[model samples]
Target: MKNSGEELHFRMDLGDSIEAREQSMISFYKRQRVDWTAPLTCTLEGDAAIGDGVKRHCLSSVMSKLQFGFEWKIGAGKTLLFEGEKDHLVPAASQVFVDSDLFVVAGRMIGHSFLHNGPCLTGLSQAVIHVLGGGMPEMASIDIEDCCDTDVREAVELLKGSAELTADQKRSIQSLASGWDLPGVTEENRRWLTEKILFHAVLSRSKGQVKQLRKGLKETQVLDLVTKRPDTLPLLFPRSCAVLYSPQLLLERIIWPAESDSGDETDDTSLEEKCRISGFLREYIENASSQCLQELLKFWHGWEVPPKELYVEVVHGLMPRSSTCMETLRLPSHYISYDAFREALNAAISSVPTGFGLV
Candidate 1:
């Protein structure tokens, strides 16, 4: 993705890459002109056994760190992000988020990923994206589903679901409201309380965190474009539709190996065998659920971000493996039937706990 034959190098380890990435970004930010447009060329340390770079293998590994909160090397680590309703990602509200400077790190990641044509942070709550893009908290269009905290969601539901509340429920609601300096639950203000609770759960609670995110985005200069053109939000933080990995999409992106130009009949049988295995993959993709589609994409190319093409090769091996650096899937042609192929691919995909590396 680097147009000028230029790439930046950083050392990373799978376990400590987040810390490594933080330092790398910190170094970049220290530069007088933080160039957001340049592509990242990363190489992993401690992965001498795994090795890095297919151009993408290490880059994907590092960029993958941008999506979630880093479990700090110090005490009481944080899971910077959590899933909300419909599995959209929303920032978690914790002092640790601010303390770790996750907002700053995440913004740089988003911008770098975007510019490098790597993964985009998909399925982010639209409301949160609005806030990160500099929309006011009060102006954020949030849904009850966007609130990831169970207690808060439940409290809001109870307030809205029934007029009468049990004593315990009432106290719970009051305590939650009190934490945010909102009014106690009363017959006359149920509507107001429900609204405020929803607001508090989604935006108010993360006010400082989101503020830092905006500051971070400004450092990347992505905020400058987002504020200037609201439509660009979908590119950085895409909605569900923009990220749907349909069977056809995957099938189309695949770059099948070219047939040998020589008229070697031996190559004919091997090409047939490869296509047969590919048939299994095609059928598997055809019926896969959205989650499975993502798993396959991740297995094939590191993160689920769609690439222009995914190079596929049939190999004489016992198992399937992918190189995100080269955007290639080395499929072992050992399986003779569809079920065997499916099972192998499934196991291979599951082995990667994170989308980028093997477990």
Candidate 2:
């Protein structure tokens, strides 16, 4: 019985020793694994607190439970085996760290590109053609396919009416209109084209003295011109007319005169003179009469032995020659805080002469 007890005790001692050796092997392997899998030297802090104590403890506990030669996963279905080489383990750890950051970077780039409003290839091409029409012979001209029928018709009418366009320019425009095949034309496109043609016509006419009529003409006079001779106003005014005349008011009341005051005889005489001038100008424009002769008549009618302020205003407004000049000008927004910029722009505007004369 004693021998039996001794044998049992020996077996138990052997089992305990085997466990101790297994634990020793595991500890040695864990030390080697940590060293091998350490991040790049630049990423390492010499201080131990920079590494989480709880995480290290958990990793060691997991490693101790893992059997030698068994494989385990650390991330996204990637496998790490307990054959335990530092080289293999370090690469896996680096890849896991880099993967998350790479995803974040890629996501941010896509969002930025989506939000960017820089001109696209289509818009760039359109802008080039608009700036340099028919100048680039080698490049295939983009057809004005989106222009509306109304717009095309208006352009044709404007070209026909414009004394500014040379015979050659008129012919070229007509030929372009006849040859061009525009599809899916819209109201907006038509309006856009009409304005564009009118703008070009005004630019062409700007070299002559007739461009002066735009300066200081009251809103009432402008509407009368538009109502009487629609063709001439559109041809002469272009963008400037739009600025001077209100389309909404014109549409609502074709003729709107200013209210008269009964207190002053001078005011009454001035009003009568304006009324006469307005009527005569309307008649002359409607009849397609000569502009030079019409201006001379306007001067004679408004002229006085002693020129009154009203007479001067009338002469300046109706004269064929005026000091007004169109330029690349813009008004600052009301919300802007830059007072200097606003003041500079206003000064430039004021420099333009408001006086007028017959050509």
Candidate 3:
């Protein structure tokens, strides 16, 4: 039965990315005849050309939305979808997510995207990657930082290296532990309790989701590839979300506006400003920190996964703008110095911290 609550179309709302993709996956993923190798075709509801580029954009958009928007909550309504540091994230356990078949959608979506040469889901913890690649849960190395639940973290932190817990503290620790169906915390079982909580929070809770994801990969035939090669897992699910590019590397990716072949009188002056601004940009990127680079990429192409090239344009304006869909970066050609250029670039990226990909 088709889900009538939300209609699936190429011109779907970015905010409704989850619901839209979910409907489409549920409709198609189960069909054994669905060709994973077939090229994806997409178009807006209205008149528009449906091409591979739009298909690429669609896949990229889905995973990015899934990363930040489709998150579950923990204590105080804190998010617990992808836990651990910014660079290293593990899929957090959520009964709500599993029940909703979201993990299944995620797994299938990633496999579909991979078959089409789309984006990889970044920042996955090495521990989860091991299991995705067929490693046993017990042998997989776990970490304290990998736990997303603040309640668990606090309880474990309090119990670790403490001579004794105050009566109130012990009760608090025991209370939360009981919620996860864990036994009472004792001095003798403190280590056992901590390990159990961490494992449960990170893996045991998310086993079903992982299973569904692997099943999706199997349906897409990607699981067979990974199971046989075992080395291709990291390529599909890398550890870091940001790809650090050097100044030279980024500059090389710029597809600078070509000089006019016709002898237009304004061409010479336009080319001069383009050259000057490009120099200014090169200098700024040379000194740019990792955060700045990541932000710039988001501002340029919507996501940190660098495209093969970025189209650059020098426009007659005071601020910079980007069309993520077009992979184009438009800059004002009025800057006189590197410092002015750098300041404006920083301000532009910071202005839309939440939506760097938007114009």
The 10-residue segment of model 1 with minimum total lDDT is: 46-55
Given candidate 1, what's the lDDT at residue 313?
77
Better model by TM-score: candidate 1 vs candidate 3:
1
Q: Native-vs-model 1 lDDT?
A: 0.70
Instruction: Write down the RMSD of candidate 2 (Cα, Å).
Output: 38.6
Clashes of each: 4, 0, 0
- Model 2: which residue pairs collide? none
Q: What are the TM-scores, per candidate, against the unseen true structure? A: 0.77, 0.17, 0.71
Residue-level lDDT of model 1, residues 1-359, one tens digit each, is 33564455554444654566556545554454455555555655445324333334544544555555444443456444444554357776767767867666667767666666667776788788888887877887777788888898889889888659889989999999998899889888998889888888888777787787777677667788899999998887877677777888888888776566145444543767777877777789899988799878877776677789888777677788777667788788778888888888898888654334442
Task: Summarize candidate 2's per-residue lDDT along 215-290 as a digit string, tens digits.
Answer: 1121113323434554543232222112222222222322323335334344433555545444443343344323
After superposition, the stretches of candidate 3 with alpha carbons farther than 4 Å from their true spots are: 1-33, 45-52, 70-88, 166-187, 245-248, 255-270, 283-303, 308-359
lDDT of 3: 0.69
TM-score of candidate 3 on Cα atoms, chains taken together: 0.71
Candidate 1 — which pairs collide?
54-325, 56-325, 57-325, 69-80
Residue 227, candidate 3: C-alpha displacement in angstroms? 2.3
Candidate that scores best on lDDT: 1
